[model samples]
Target chain A: MIEVEALTKRYGSTLAVDDLSFTVRPGLVTGFLGPNGAGKSTTMRMVVGLDHPTSGTATINGRPYAASPAPLREVGALIDAKDVHGGRSARNHLRAVARSNGLPDSRVDTVLGLTGLDAVAGRRIKGFSLGMGQRLGIATALLGDPGVVMFDEPVNGLDPEGILWIRNLLRGLAAEGRTVLVSSHLMSEMAQTADHLIVIGRGRLLADLSMTDFLEQNGRTHVQVKSPRQDDLAPLLRAAGGTVEPDHDVLAVHGLTCEQVGDIAAAHGLALHQLFEQRASLEAAFMDMTRDSVEYGSGSLPPPPDSALPPPPDSPDRPGATEVAP
Target chain B: MTLPASPTANAASPFALDGPVHHPTTLDVVRSEWLKLRTVRSTFWTLAVTVVVMVGFSVLVCAAQVATWDQLTAEEQQANPINGVSSALAGLSLAQLAVVVLGVMVISSEYSTGGIRSTFTAVPRRARVVVGKAVVLGLSTLVVGLVASFVAFFVGQLILATKHFDVALGDPDVLRAVLGSGLYLAACSLFGLGIGLIVRNTGGGVTISVAALFVLPPLTALIPGTVGDQIQKFITSNAGQSVAATGSAPDRLGPWVGYLVFTVWWLVLIGVGTWLVRRRDV
Candidate 1:
């Protein structure tokens, strides 16, 4: 388990990570989601002790990362795929990392094969493609076989096959009771792979909950009604307490269930061709939750409705504002 | 783009997380550094160039001296006699440039390529990583420097012996000079490593190292009187180069004492580098 408490990092005048705190538990893949420049990378770096925190502590398995007897054996991280020395071969790169933690040379070959880098293990890293470089990074992370693994944007330069491979790899790692935390800006990707999510925007936590709860709490639902006499049905639905908006041949009704709309339509003796309840996708929910906090959002666009926006920073109703006990 | 359907088939077997963990000591770090140093082509090429330059200059200078021996007047020949130690080690001045470049590249390349992050992640005690690189670079360069020095001495002496002016290794202070030449090159390498750590960029580190070792030593000559003399004695190249010289002079520092001063220069630089490395964000 990786525990981060009240962690904050400041680069000059810019507050990159502001009092962020969260726990990444074992036996699950926790997706760390954020918009661009939201401090996901900075948080991961601080967790591994690469960048010193301005305040607070990040501990892995009950102690600071550096305090571990064998840090690589305790926690392994791939902060950047391009961080390896290009002049060295893949085999040599893994060998150096393995030797640092007193791991056997055989482990290097094992990871090489596991990451499908065995064929190109002897080649210099400079000659490898970006996908190959990412593979090498994953190979290095798995070198010591640590209990906790963290990856920052692991799918940046991968092919579809490579992406699927990594998804399986992360799920497999978590299935073995290891703590796996992977960061990405793509909510759709996280939807498929993450069992839980910790969402952040503008360097502050917006929500922390399970996948099911996230979809249930943030995803909006609407009823689609298509009728032969749409003009007559629109006014009745609006008068009956549902916000009705007309689309090409249908009426999108919010704030009422499909059953309620159907019963009201029957009472008014309106003929209905089709009726169904549509729950907004997780992607749309994620966008709505973080729209107000996007760091580099397009400036000319009009603001979202007040009800769609999250609670203000100082508001007592804001979720994830206070730490939750694990 | 095509990968095996089951890429992580052996992942469960390889990552037996239940196994005992072994804490890495400084020795383990040294081993890692040694592997890293040898795996790069730049390391091999730089050291090779250093050896070639050292040995080549010794032979060429000795040959040129032999060719001009008969043309010198009797008084000129008496006043400036051929010294075996200085003659064989003449190439050291040029060879040190290669040594400095190699030393700087050892650490600077990591920063330039973003490899330092991986290095630090593997071994989080940041100072230990610096010490590990120093140990590996120090030992390897010492070996290479000694080999180059001995070869240049033997070859240069053979060429000088053709004109019957060669001095024997058994001669007073001759062996010390030869051994000191190797020591000087190793020190130059460490000096470059220290500068690399501080600058953390290849171009900047090389420029700064060259300026300090070569440009600064000559500029000190423009200063006049005892003040200039004192400053010249403490300049990095002047102090370190004295060890490789055959005899002491009134204006210069003694060989061993000069080497001591040179050692301190790199030691202090490395110390500052270690301290900054822990505080700086990678």
Candidate 2:
């Protein structure tokens, strides 16, 4: 388990991570979701002890990282993909990190094979493509086979195959009951991969809920009924225990199931062309929950990810994107 | 704000997987440092140049001194018979540039490439990693430097044999000058490494290394009399040259005192470097 408690960092007057606290539990893939400037990377650094916390501390399992004897064996992290010295070959780079933790030479080759970099293991890191460099970074992380693994923006520049590779890799790691904390800006990826989501905004936790719980808590179930005689059906649905918001061609009906709406229209002798249930999307829900906390709110269309999952609801100023726990 | 888990979480329990045995040991760090050194093409070329320049420069300078011997008086010839052998080590002036650059690259490249984060993550005791690298780097460079200087001294003496100015290793300070010059070069390189660790930038570390070793001495020499005497007595490269010289120049520093001065310069820089590497963000 990786525990970070009340960790804060200050660069002059700017507070990079402000009293940020979260835990990466064992046996599940926990996706750390946040927008840009959300202190995700800074928080990870504090966890690994790379950046000292100004106020509190971060640790792995139990004790402080500095106090840990086999740090590489306990908490392996890929904080930056391009962290290797360009002048050194991939093999030598892994060797240097491996030797630091007192691991044997065989482990370096093992990681190379595991990451499928044995072919270019001897090539200088300067010549590596971004994906190859990321592979090296992941290899270094797995060198000691630490129980806890943390990856910062692991799929930032990956192709589809590479993305799929990491998705399966992380899931496999977590399946072994290891603590896995992965941070990403994309909501779609988190929707599919993460079992539990710890969404943050502006350095504060917006939600720490399971995917099922998030969807259930944010359930805003309603029904849409469109008909030529919606004026006659509106009074009938309202009398039948439904809240009705009338539009030009449809009545947005709440508190009634789609089947009930259809039954009510037919019983009232109103011909309905369209009747369907409606619930806010996950992306729309997420946006509504974190609307106020977004540090880099951009209007640009997000790049479409492979997941067919839709966007959650737009985050609200309060919490959980206007969560209506049903 | 929902703060992350505090540092004090799970402070009591001792896991079987964790303890003092888990941290990186000195021997492992040394091996790691060696890998870092050998992997760099620049390190190989730097050592090669240090060797080639030391030997080739020594031969040429020794020959020039031998050819010019006929014009000088016996007194002038006796006092400076080795043709400013220490001064003929002028190639070291150029050689030190490579050493300084290599030293700076070792530490600062980690920062430029964002690899410091990975390295520090592996070895949480950051200071030990730096010290281990410094030790390996200091010893290996010194050994190579000694070989190069020795070869240069012997080859130079062989060329001077024709002029009857051949000086043997048995001479009072010949061996010391040869071996000590190598050590001096090594220490100078380490001094550069120290600055690099503290600076943590290629441009800044290199600039500081060059300024301290190259520009500082020449600028301080113009500091007017005794004030300059007190200050320049401790500049690393300047004091190192004095320490390796068999016979002193009119304005040169004393040999042992020069080494002390050299030590003071590096010690201060390294102390700061260690502190920063320990306490600051990687």
Candidate 3:
């Protein structure tokens, strides 16, 4: 378990990270999400004692990182690609770090085979591309087989196969009861991979919750009705206290059940072309939760209204958001 | 090694960086430092140049002096006071540059390549890291310097044999001169490591070391009197070169005294460098 308490870091006058507190539980993949320059790297640096925290503390298994006798065997982190020397061969590089913890010479070859760099282990790092470099960094992180493994932007420059390989590797590691924290800006990827989400923006914790809870609390639901006599149903919807918006030839309604909408349409004897319900996707939910917290604002003009409007809350979409999973 | 159910690192566990091992013993740190020093291609060439320049140039200078030794008038020869043997081992002025560059690269290369982060991560205790590097590099250069200076002395003496000029290791003061020259080069290398640590940059450290040891000492001697005396006494090049002198000048310190002054300079610089390293962000 890793506990970060009131962790704050300031680089000069700019607050790089602020009062961030969270606990990472074992046996799950926790996704750390943030845009560029949002203190993710700085926070990781402080966790490893690479950068001193401006205030607060971070601990792994309830003690500070530097206080451990064998740091490599406790937690492993691939902070980034910049933590390697270019001239040393991958084999020798791993050997150098491996020997530090009283690790035997044989373990170097283990990591070499694990990262699939066994073929090029003798090659100098200066010649390796970004993908190869990341492999080497991963090899180093996994050298000691520690309980906690963290990666920052692990798939930045990977090919499709490499990406899938890393994804499965992370899941496999977590399944073994290890604490895994992977940071990325790709919501689609995180949605499929992370079992929990820790979202932050502007160097402050915005949301810290499980994936299901976040999806539950964030996205909106509504119902859609397309009827020729929708004008007659508008008054009934108003009487039902359902909010209405005219979306093209359809009226989108909120706060009314699907049965109520159907009954209201039948009473008016309106010929309905279509009646459906819709709930937001995980992408939309993430965007909604982080819209205001987003550090980088595109400032683009809002999109123009379209004919294919969203469904009303009275539709099936309403039940999707309202139904709580036990 | 078997993987324990849980890492039983009790008793104020200090080496948990989420990556990289920590608190590696001084020996481990030294081993890693040695690996780091030699793996870089630049290290080999610099040391090679140091040996070749020390031996080759000293032999050349000695042979040249041998060629003209018989032509000097008796009074002029007395005034010049030839020590063909000692002069042959006098190429440290040029050789110091090679050792200086070798020393600077030991530390500065890490900064230039962003490898210091990895090094510190593996051994978080900054002081021990520097000491480990100093030990391996100091001993390596010491052995190499002794060999190179000895070779240069013997080869130069052989070249000057036909001119009726030669130096024996048993000759009065010759033993000290030969030993002193080797010590001088080794001290210069350590002095270079100090500059490298303090500057933490290749260009700045190399420039400072070369200028302080090679460029300034002789120029300052032109100032004359107390100023020159003071400058020369402190200059590592001038004071360090005392080890190779057949006879000491009144103003010049004894060879051992000179080595001490130079050693002190390196120690002070290394101390300050380590302090900054511990306090500063990587």
Candidate 4:
């Protein structure tokens, strides 16, 4: 488990990470979601003791990461896929890291084989493609078999195969009861991989909830009704307290369940062709949740309605903020 | 299409570090650093080139001196003296750049390639990493410098013996001069490593180290009067060369003192660099 308490990092006058606190539990893949410059990278770095926190603490397991006797064996992190000596071969790079933490030479070959880098392990990393570089990074992170693993933007530059490989790798790691925290900007990716999410925007925690809770709260479930007489059914559904938006022959009804909408249509003797519930996508839900919190949001669209979102009761906005976990 | 077994499940592993995690010892870090220093082609080629330049210059200069032995005027020959070791090590003035390149590359390349993050991740004690690199690079350069110096001295003395002006390693001040050159070269390398750590950029690190050792001395000479003379004595190359020279001059500092001055410069650079490294974000 990783416990971050009031972690704040300020770069000069700019606050990179502000009063961030969260716990990444084991036995699940926790998605660390944020837009670019949302302090995801900085937080991960501080967790691993690469960047010192300004006024807070981050610990892996129970103790601070630096205090751990064998850092690599206790917590492994892949902060950047390209953070490697390009001149060195993949085997040598992994060996150096393995040896530093008192790990044996054989582990290097083991990780190499696991990452599918054994075939070209002898080649210099400078010649490796971006996907290959990412695999090498994963190899390094997995070399010591640490109980906690954190990856920052692991799939930024990967082919479909590489992405699939990483998705499975994360799932496999977490299935082994390891604490797996992976950061990504894409919620669609997270929806498929993450069991829980700790989302941040503008260096503040926007949401800390399970993928199911997040989808339930933000991803509104709506009933779409396609009828032969939509003109007659629209008013009945609206009068029944369902917000209705007409698109050609179908009515998108919100704030009511599909059964309720079906009953209303049946009461009106409206011949309905189709009535299906459209579950709000995690991507749309995430976008709606973090829309205001985005630091570099494109200003082309007007700001979202304030009433559309209420601050999550447990969102850590500042020091001593609420600790809400789903 | 072979899929390796999961790391956590591999019980056949000879390196299952279960139970308690032990912090790596200094020796472990140093050994890792040794592996890091030796695996790269740049480190190998740079040191190899440095040795070639140091010894190669010795042979070339001695050969030219021997060929012109008969044509030179007696006073000309006497004024243009060749210390058997100094002549052999003369190529160091050119060869030191190799050490500088290797030194700077040792740290700066990590930044350029983004390897520093991985380095600090594996070894969270940032200061230990710096010390490990310094110890590894400094000792490696020192050994190479010593070997190259001895080889050059022997080769140059052989050629000088052709002209009947050879001096053995046992001659007065010869051993100190030869040994001092090796130390000086090693010091130059540490100086480069220190600068590299500070800058963390290859181009900037190399340029600054070169300017300190080569450009600054000549620039100080342009400074007018006794001020220039006084300043030049402390300039890295000038102070460092005192250790390389066979005889002491009335105006110059002692050999060991010069080495002390040069050594202090590198230590200060490395100390400040490591301090900043500990505090700065990767």
Candidate 5:
């Protein structure tokens, strides 16, 4: 389990992480979600003792990460994919890390196989592609078989197959009763892979809840009714205390369930062509909730095509428009 | 698509599947540092150049002096002995550069490649990591340096032996000079390491180290007279060069004192580097 309490990090005048607090429990995948520059990377760095926190504390398994006798054995983190030496082969690079933590050489081979890097284990890291580099980072994190595993942007540069592999790998890690904290800016990806989410914006916690709860609270559901007597249905729905909005050929009813709308239509003996509930997508809910918190939002749309300015009058054909040099 | 079985499915805990986990001692870190230093191609090239410069050039310089021995006047022969151990180690000035570069790379390469984060993550006690690197770099350079020095001494003396003017290890001050040359180069290597830690970038660390060892002494000499003498006594290469000298030069510390002065430069550089490592974020 990972617990962060009142953690704050300030870089110069800007607060990178501010007064953040949350607990990540085991047996589930917890997503650390934020937009760019939201302090996700800084927070992870502080958790592993790479960066000092300005105030407060972060603990893995009830102790500061550095205080653990076997730090790599207690917590495994893949902070950056390009942390390996390019001159060294993949096997030697992992061997050096393993040897530092007193892990057996055999475990290096195991992690290599687990990450599907055994085929090119003897090649220098400089030759590996970005996807392979990510795989190496994952292999390094799993080298010690730690109880807590954290990955920062693990799927940043990956093929579809590689992305799927990591999604399953994260679920499996949590299923094994290990605490997994994965950070990403992609909300749709989080919606699929994460069981719970700790959302942040501008270094502050925006929401700390489960996926189901988030969807239930922010996701809107409305019933749509299309019929030949839509004008009659609209007044009946409004009279029954439902807010009704008219589309091109249908009536949209809010604050009422599909069954209620169906019963109301039947009671009026109105022939209904269609009546169904439309639930908002999680992506839409996420966008709506984080709309005010986005850091780099554009304020207005671009100018129309007709607004393109005419050419300047300094051409040779318009010689009089050009002023003489002083 | 079939999912792979969970790595920890059957295991009760992380340690249970891996058998008993071993927490790394400082010795293990030192061992890993040794492996790290030797595995890179840069280390191999640096050491190879050091050997060629120190040993190969020593033989060539001494051989050239002998070929011109007949043209020298009696006073010239008396003042500059051709058969001493110092003459056998004449190439050290050029060879020192190779050792210094390797020493700086021991730490700076990790910083440049972003590997220091991985290293510190595995071993969070930053002091232990630095100390381990120092121990490995110091000891290996001492060994390689001693081998290079001995080879140079023997080869140069072998050429001198042809003219019946050779000195042996049993000769007075012969063994000390040869052994001291090795110690001098080893100290120079550690001096590079200290600079490396201070400036984490490879290019900057190497430039500063090279300038301190090779450029500053002559530049200080341009000051002239007593002021120059005082400044030159503390310059790392000038003060340290006495260790391998066959005889004492004027206005310089004796052999051991010069080594001690050279050692202080490393201590101060390393102290500052260690302080910064603890205070700064990776």
Candidate 6:
């Protein structure tokens, strides 16, 4: 397990990480979600002892990382994919890190094969593509076979197949009862891979919850209804305890499900043309939670012609954009 | 993208991996650093240039001296006799620059390429990493310097032998001068590394190293009087090259004393560098 207690890092006058504390437990993939400049990288750096904490501590396995007799054997972190020397071959680079911890050369070859880098291990890192570099970074992280593994934006430049491979790999790591902390701005990827989430914005904790609770609490869901006798249905729905906001031709109803709205419409003998439930995607929920905390909030753009328009689909597989009648 | 099974998958707990926890010693760090230094092409090329320049320049200078021997009168020859030690080590003035470039690159390239983060992350005791690099670079340069010095000494002596002016290895101060050439090159390498650590930029580190070793020595000559003479005696290159001198002049420092002063300069720079490296965020 990794525990951070009131960890803070200040650069000059700017607070890069401010009084942050979170525990990453074993057997789970904890998603560290944050907007750009939200101290995710700073927090990881402090955890690995790369950057000194101004006034707090980050410990791995109940001791400061620096205090560990064999830190690499206890914690493996891929803080930056491009941190390796470009001039060295992939195999030699891993060997240097391995030798630092007194790890055997056999372990280097194991990680090389594990990350699908065995074929290119002889090649110089400068020749590797971004995706290959990321894979090599992962290979380095797994070199020591540590219990705690952390990756920062692991899938930034991967192809579609590589993305799928990493998602499965993270899940597999967590399944083996290892602590995995992954940070990314991609909400869709987090929604799929993260078992728990620790969300931060502008160097402050905004939310910490499970994947299910995060979606249920922050992701808003509403019923979209259209009717010829919409004027009659509007009051009847509100009187029935559902908040109704009338749009051009549809009524965006909150606090009620599709069945409730349909039951009321049928009871009053009101004609309904279309009715469906619109569940906000995780991306939409994250946007709402961090709207004010964004470091570089783009100036407000004019709202769409319809205020009740549904958020874009979370992923291509979800088909969240298509309205379905039930 | 089928990942092989994780090595720790079958372990009862995440922390319970096989093998005793071995805290890395300084030796381990040195080995790792040696691997780092040898794996790069630049290290090989720089060392190659140092050897070639040191040996090549010595041979050419000795050959030129032999070619001009017959043109001088006996009185003129006696007044300006060829010093075997100086002749064999003449290449050092040029070869030391190559060693300086390689030394600065050893640490500065890590900063430029963002590789320092990986290095620091592996060995959180930041001072140990610096020590490791210093040890590896120092030892390797020392060996190479010795090799280059011996080769230049033998080859230069062989060339001067044609004119019957050759000096043997057992001649007074001849062996000291040859050995001193190696020590001088090693010191030059460390000096460059110290500058590199302090500056943390290849171009800036090389610029400062060259300025200290070459530019400042000559500039000190214009200081005008006893003060100028003293400053020139203590300047980096002048003091460092003193060790390779066969005969000491009254105004110059003793060979060992001059080398000691040169050693002190690098120690100060490297010490400050270690302190900064430990405190600074990678």
- TM-scores of the candidates in the order shown: 0.91, 0.87, 0.85, 0.89, 0.89, 0.92
Identify the superior model by lDDT, candidate 3 or candidate 4.
Answer: 4
lDDT of 6: 0.85
- Per-residue lDDT tens digits for candidate 5, residues B1-282, read 211223464765333244555667898899878788888999889888888888888788888888888899999989976755777898888788899999899888988888888998888888888899989888888888899999999999888887777888997778888888899888888888889988987799889988999988878877888878888887898888778876667867788888899999988888888889877777
| Count of backbone collisions in candidate 5 | 0
In model 5, which regions exceed 4 Å deviation?
A: A223-232, A239-242, A246-252, A255-277, A299-326, B1-16, B224-227
**iRMS values in order, in angstroms?**
9.6, 11.0, 10.5, 8.9, 10.8, 10.5
Model 6 earns a TM-score of 0.92
Candidate 3, residues B62-149, lDDT tens digits: the string is 8778778789999988998668656778677888889888888888888777677677665666777899888878888888888888
Give lDDT per model, in order. 0.85, 0.77, 0.77, 0.83, 0.83, 0.85
Chain A, model 1: TM? 0.84
In TM-score terms, which candidate is top?
Answer: 6
lDDT of 4 by residue, B1-282 (tens): 111223455444422434444557777788899999999999889989988998899999989878987898999978987667677778878778889989999998888777888999999888889888999998999999989888888889988998777898788888988888889889998999899989988899999988899888878878888878888788887788788778767646789988898888999999999998988877
Candidate 1 lDDT, B74-181, residue by residue in tens: 999999888877888888888888888988999988887889889989899988898899999988888999999999999998999998888888988888888888
Tens digits of per-residue lDDT, candidate 4, A26-74, equal 8799999977677888899899998889999998877888777777777
Q: Return the lDDT, model 3, position A299.
A: 66
Please give the range of 10 consecutive residues that has the lowest summed lDDT in model 5 chain A. A317-326
Off by over 4 Å in 4: A235-249, A254-269, A272-275, A302-326, B1-20, B218-230
Cα lDDT, model 5, residue B40: 94
Query: What tens digits encode model 5's per-residue C-alpha lDDT throughout A215-241?
Result: 778667889889999988998888889
Candidate 6 lDDT, tens digit per residue, A1-326? 88999998887777778899899999999999977777888899899998899999998888888877776877789988888889999999999999988888888888887789999999999999999999999988887777789999899899999999999989988887889999987687799899999998777788889998987786778999999999989999999999999888999999999999999999989999999997766776676677676665556853243133233322211111121110
Error of 3 at A161 (Å): 1.5
Clashing pairs in 6: none
Candidate 3: lDDT of A244?
Answer: 90
